[model samples]
Target: MHIEEKQIAINKVAALLKNSGKFVLSIDKNKDGFIDTGTRKITVFPDTPAEMKSYIENSGLLLIEQFETEFAHIFIAEKG
Candidate 1:
């Protein structure tokens, strides 16, 4: 998704959360787009971890914890 669309989605998620509710997301760590094996199509604009974090934080969600795996970054955020 485009950056603006992604941010809008994040904001919507934040708006849907009840007080103290948690949001968990796992995103590809690589900024470089990769091909989808099933569809044989390449991702054109995947959000970077930094961008995703910024979006979540900007949406009025407080970041609780974040971790990185071999291929992805996991974010745990809470609606204040």
Candidate 2:
């Protein structure tokens, strides 16, 4: 996904967690337009969700769907 879409996804995941203690954020590139299916480097900004960011940092998880560059993807999940 592009920058705009990535941000939207992150926000949606954060909102989803507001009602639940845990949540997972994923995208199907085959339909989402990201043809590069694999782990794309996801950077954490100061504004990134605290819980989700923490999980990523702690686990150093690779949240990318792997395949071809045409199908870009990333997967992030958190439980606490």
Candidate 3:
């Protein structure tokens, strides 16, 4: 997704949560390729880990924890 769209989505998510509600997001940092799910092909948007983190924090959510796996970055944020 484009940056503007991503931010808008984040804002929407943030608006839905109650105060102190937690949001968990997992982003594939290496999503530069397409995925074939047998029946359809899914296009993954290329978004960096840092950019995603920034988006989460900038949406009035306080980042509480973050970690990375071999394939993705996971962020735990709370609506503040």
Candidate 4:
């Protein structure tokens, strides 16, 4: 993603956090669009995907999504 999109995604993720916690933020590029089909990294929030979902769902930020894993959970907030 571009710098602007990256910044927007970061802000969205930050707004989704309820408490003060560390989050992994990166750009995910294994997507369809050009922005999503490169060496993109993702911003993984310290909170689980569940927590991110709640905040994101209600934060009015409609340009991102959340994903998670089992052992090493991964949360991805993208700009759509």
Q: Is candidate 2 or candidate 4 better by lDDT?
A: 4
Which candidate should be chosen as best, given lDDT against the real structure? 1
What C-alpha lDDT does candidate 3 achieve relative to the native structure? 0.84
What is residue 66's positional error in candidate 1, in angstroms? 0.8
TM-scores for every candidate against the unseen true structure: 0.80, 0.27, 0.87, 0.28
Instruction: Determine which window of 10 residues in candidate 1 has minimal summed lDDT.
Output: 28-37
Off by over 4 Å in 3: 1-4
Candidate closest to the true structure, highest TM-score? 3
For candidate 2, write residues 1-80 as lDDT tens digits: 23444445555555556432444443333333343336674433322334334444454333332222343334445433
lDDT of 3 at 55: 90
Model 4 C-alpha lDDT per residue in residues 1-80, reported as the tens digit of each score: 33334445656666666554445433333332333336774433233345445544454444243443443444443332
State the RMSD for candidate 3.
2.2
TM-score for candidate 4? 0.28
lDDT digits (tens) for residues 1-80 of candidate 1: 32338888899999999999999998876666665669576654687788888999999999999999998899999999
Instruction: Encode model 3's per-residue lDDT on 40-64: one tens digit a residue.
Output: 8777667887888889988989999
- Superposed model 4: Cα runs more than 4 Å off: 1-4, 26-80
